[model samples]
Target: MKHDDYDNLNEGTRSRIRAKRRKTNLILNSLIVVVILLIGIVSFNIFFSNDEGAADQNGVVAEKDQDAASRDKKEDSKDAGKKEDSQESGKKEADESESEEEADEESAEEEELSDPIVTEGGSDANVKQTIENPEWKPVGTTQSGEHTTVFDQNAVDWQEMILAYSYATGIDKDNMTVWFNGNGGAPNTAVGTISEKGSDQTFRVWIEWVDGEGWKPVKVEELIQNDQKQS
Candidate 1:
């Protein structure tokens, strides 16, 4: 309490009291140091734990973003593949349609052809039969524009005329002999006398020029003799 009272105490009691105070102070200081160390350990654990948790959270977020991007890429690839497939399919269908159209055109062209007509000839001359074909098409020509009847043996028109005669009379060109080729009764018309080389199968073939088509045989008369043959 009072310094005068403590100083008036006995020497042995003063010495014991002073020693007790020193021990109590030392124990208090040691307890304070232990409390400080405990506080530091707790703070360090809390800070590090929070940092690890944040890192784990960031990692989860990053993983989710990567997964989303991968999914988007897959979707885009699928869309591109689908677009390519659609284009290829359309092209295939167009090609098939064009091919079908071409086939139809070819079939239509083939349907236009028909057989020839054969009938008995008049008794006016040595005629066997009359041959006519309504579906007869002119032989194709290399010539263009206005047509003129050519009678020269080396002319293209003359060669075509002989071809028409062979076509109408059903005679092979190699086995037939052309006796005459001259102008008929009308313009753009010609008559030819042809006979089988080694036989008496003679015919008078009448042919006419048709614009774009070459020589078209209009009539064919099977003759018993080549009346136009030169002596």
Candidate 2:
């Protein structure tokens, strides 16, 4: 409209038009502000929700890691326990093997020793029984090289003869009384007559010396009486 026409219009009409425009502008401004506020609230809620979701996901991941670690620890402990048990079992087996080896050695030693042979018949009336052992070995000798028979009381041969007599008759030195110790009829041979300390049981032992070996008992005759005993 021209300014002349607007000036020709009544005041009431102009006032109403201005008031309508003012009301419309006020409503539009208020709607815009409300829409902006709603948008801001939605954005805030979305941001907070996203942050909370991320936190929950991280927490789940952390929980899974902890569970995995715990399982690994338990498995390691089980493995360690099995290793210890295996070691203990191995130790027990080794001990059993050692015990078996020891038992075998002891059995072998027992098999090496043999019993003597006892029989009847003697050359004299005083001789009752005879004894011999094929398994008997020399008691060993300290003297080497050439050997000479010594008849002295303090001779080494005499002491060794007594040992042979005791070995053949099963009579110890502490319980036996020597009746006679002298040369036998053959070369490199000796004879000894002995009796128990408090009994009439007597024995005559014949021993021979080998070139390299010591005195070894050849025969033992058990006597019926202590006829060779002195005093």
lDDT of each: 0.86, 0.85
* lDDT by residue for model 2 (22-66), tens: 999999999999999999999999999999999999999999999
lDDT of 1 by residue, 155-211 (tens): 989988888887777688888888888998899999988888888777888899999
User: Which run of 10 residues does model 2 get worst, by summed lDDT?
Assistant: 108-117
For candidate 1, what is the TM-score?
A: 0.50
lDDT, residue 191, model 1: 92
TM-score for each predicted model, relative to the true structure? 0.50, 0.53
Instruction: Count clashing pairs, candidate 1.
Output: 0
In candidate 2, stretches whose alpha carbon ends up further than 4 angstroms from where it belongs are 1-114
TM-score for candidate 2: 0.53
